[model samples]
Target: MSLEGFLAASARGGAIPWSEELRAAREFGLSAREVEAAAFGAGLLPARYSRNAGTIGLAGQAVLHASCVAVAGCGGIGGHVIEQLARLGVGTIVAVDPDVFEESNLNRQILATVENLGLPKVEAAALRARAINPAVILRPLRARLDSRNAPSLLEGADVVADGLDTISARLELAGACARLGLPFVHAGVAGWYAQASTQAPGSSSLSDIYGHGTAPAERGVEAALGNPSFTPALAASLEAAEVCKLLLGLSGTLRGRLLHLDLLAMECAEFPI
Candidate 1:
């Protein structure tokens, strides 16, 4: 079926009409039981969802229909960010990463399995995301994110999630989003230290905290020491949760503030932007 047809079917209580469902069952490789199960999934079927499913269901539906872009660095944080976004049902994802997997990635990178050792980070992440949700549309750009393509890639995105490492790149992306009137969530990880902030257009941004060119010495040291899955996992999950809240038009978004977490100190706090 066409992409529009698929989306239309997804809107009607998650079940396509009779002929489409039969065809999908036959040609798309989905089993009859799997089709039945999907039909009953809460976000797809209003009848199947309970009142409590409202939050997740509405969040999932909004994400399932919205288009989003993420500019990421190493697959550790980037991979986890994509995983959480896909599981939450974000429909369209554009992932930017130029790096390839290496032996050193096993400790934190989600796509860094031995089998995928030589693959491009974006490709590996796209593969994993598709495995989780076949219907998810992913545009994997295996290149560095710079000023030139940042705006184009992020254009029309309902929200932007940052898993980038470099301060320069982060500032450039944040500025680009600010110009485009997009909401952005910024996340950075180094060692057991991670920080995140959300910014709406015309609001405070990453540059506000990190400055235009000055990189934090502590953040550099943390990146040099490398990050553990434990930290990226925590940070990415929080970033994804905040993204979901923003997409669903929910209140209490982590806008205009920064949240800092230090695993060693077991301390987490929010500070003004």
Candidate 2:
């Protein structure tokens, strides 16, 4: 049967179940992600994404299913962000992280597990994401993101997500995203505090906040207070929401604004950039 016919026939109440999508993927020699996209293109929803329909809608789901996102770090905030984006059905995820999961990461990094302590963070993220949604493509780049490679490393992504811990790398990525004309969704976590924002290209938002070329190697406060398990998830959730907004072309994004969260006191504040 034709994929379209199969999808149309398999759909119930305008949505296709996972079992049917999987069967179609196997029958059509396509990835589950591709089949999901076909379902969307055919005006049918994937059942697993039914919960997302009300908020995302069919148009938003189509947008998200066609979007590609680059996650610069696969630990802590990065892991959580990747997981959220995967569940949210971003079509392709380019997960970049050079570090291995050491015992230290187990405290807050979602991708860190005792059995996979020595594995690369990107690989672990891929495993987790694939498990969550095989319809989401996982691209693992087990390399450091730097100025030299940032352009090529992130060129095709619709948005670049920040999960880096150092000022130097964040600045580099923010600058590269500016040059690449890509939107950057940034988040940082330390102890009970986290901040998130979306920066448009050439906004110099990160530069304005961190200053340009002034101690690029400096690490953020996470180095001092350390990341508890909650902060990264909090920050990454904000980042993932921003990503969804950007992909869906929705308004009220954090562009030119920074959101600060005091988890300890359960307070939230927004500051203009």
Candidate 3:
């Protein structure tokens, strides 16, 4: 089949799995990426992402489809962030999480499931990404991230996401991103409130915004006020949007400011560091 023939076939199918798409493209002496581009041009990669084309354009969409994002943590915020990235056509996802799914995680963790109760969070994230976008390449690291291993664990990512549950871990992840000169999307949730920000290297670090002594008395206020299903979802959505903007080289990122959301009051406010 020629490129046109593959596009026509893709249109007729309305979607094609990655393997079949590659096989068909190879039969026509075309690269898989070229076939993917042809599919997009032919309007066969599913209209699901068509809405994004208007906002980000075909060029931006291509950028997203070729981008790689690393998510540190796979709990409530991280899981949702990773899911959104994959669904938005990020070509590769590097997810790091040492924990396993538990009953406590089902509330807001999109990758958590009853069947995966004992599975590693990174494994669950990988499975979720595969099920959502088979074409997405997911690299799961089932290990904790500290300053020592952060760089290697998060290597090669265009941007890094801070989805850690503890204040100290968040600080550590932010420091790693800064050292690597990578953009970081940081978010945290507690009860009905959540905050998000994009930290560009040399700008305001997470520590600069929250301060070194800002570590919560406890692991997080969520332990007391509780983390509802909605708070992390809202926060992670903002973080994902920031990552998308950064990946596409767009402006107006929350580089030196924090976006705070209060679901209880239904208000969103941004404040400078």
Candidate 4:
């Protein structure tokens, strides 16, 4: 079938599930990417995200349909960030993680499940994103981000998300983004506290916030305070929102300012870098 024919058959004056479209695409020997382009070109999107059109609009939605985001670290914040990006109509997402799900990750990692306990975090992220939005292309990389390989992992991305755990790793990612001139959405969570910010090119560097080098500990206070499930989700959501804003050219972003959340005290504030 021609692209128009598939659109015509699939159209009900409303959006359809990506899985349904995928089925039709396969029957017609069409790739999901082709269907995605045709569907977006025809102003059709999954009904699940139709509500976002009011905020992002058709033009912004199209931008999202053509944008690519790279997410570093696929554990707590990384997993949830990838999830929101996929559901928000991001066309492509690259998830990088060198770890796997463990029993300890069950408390805060959204991608962690008993069934996938031993699975690579990136693989789980890919599966979850695809299940949520079949049109979303997830490139899962089972590798840690470092200066040598960060550029390659992050190449061709419009924006890179910093969901990494340690201050050192986050610093590495921010430096990489700076070098590559990519927008970096940074998020961190520990217990009831969470913070997020967007580091646009020439913006404040990560070192300004976390200092010059790696911490002596592998984890932070969160390891002692105990990270509940809600903290990572909350932090990731905030970071994801900044990414969407950057993609759509929205205003009131967290760029150059750190958004801090203290869930226990029910307080929210922003501090300039």
* lDDT tens digits by residue: candidate 2, 170-216: 88888888888999899888899998888897777987677554665
> Each candidate: how many clashes?
2, 0, 0, 0
Kindly list the per-residue Cα lDDT of model 1 for residues 106-165, writing each as its tens digit. Answer: 888787899988889888877887776655667788888776887776655788888876
Candidate 4 lDDT (Cα, whole model)? 0.84
lDDT of 3: 0.81
Output the better candidate (3/4) by TM-score.
4
Worst 10 residues of 4 by lDDT: 211-220
lDDT of 4 by residue, 19-82 (tens): 6677768777777766777777877765566788788876788899899999999988999999
Show where candidate 3 strays beyond 4 Å.
1-5, 8-48, 212-218
Model 3 Cα lDDT, one tens digit per residue, 1-273: 567666666553455556667676668776655666676666566344666766877677777877889998999999999999988888889999999999988887888889999999999898898888766788999988888997788778999988789877877778778888888899989999999888897544677656565554436677798799999898889989999999998889999898888888999998886
**Residue-level error in angstroms, candidate 3, position 97:** 0.2
Runs of candidate 2 with Cα error greater than 4 angstroms are 211-213
The full ranking of all candidates by lDDT, starting with the best, is 2, 4, 3, 1
- Clash pairs, candidate 4, are none
Q: Which rank order by TM-score, best down to worst?
A: 2, 4, 3, 1
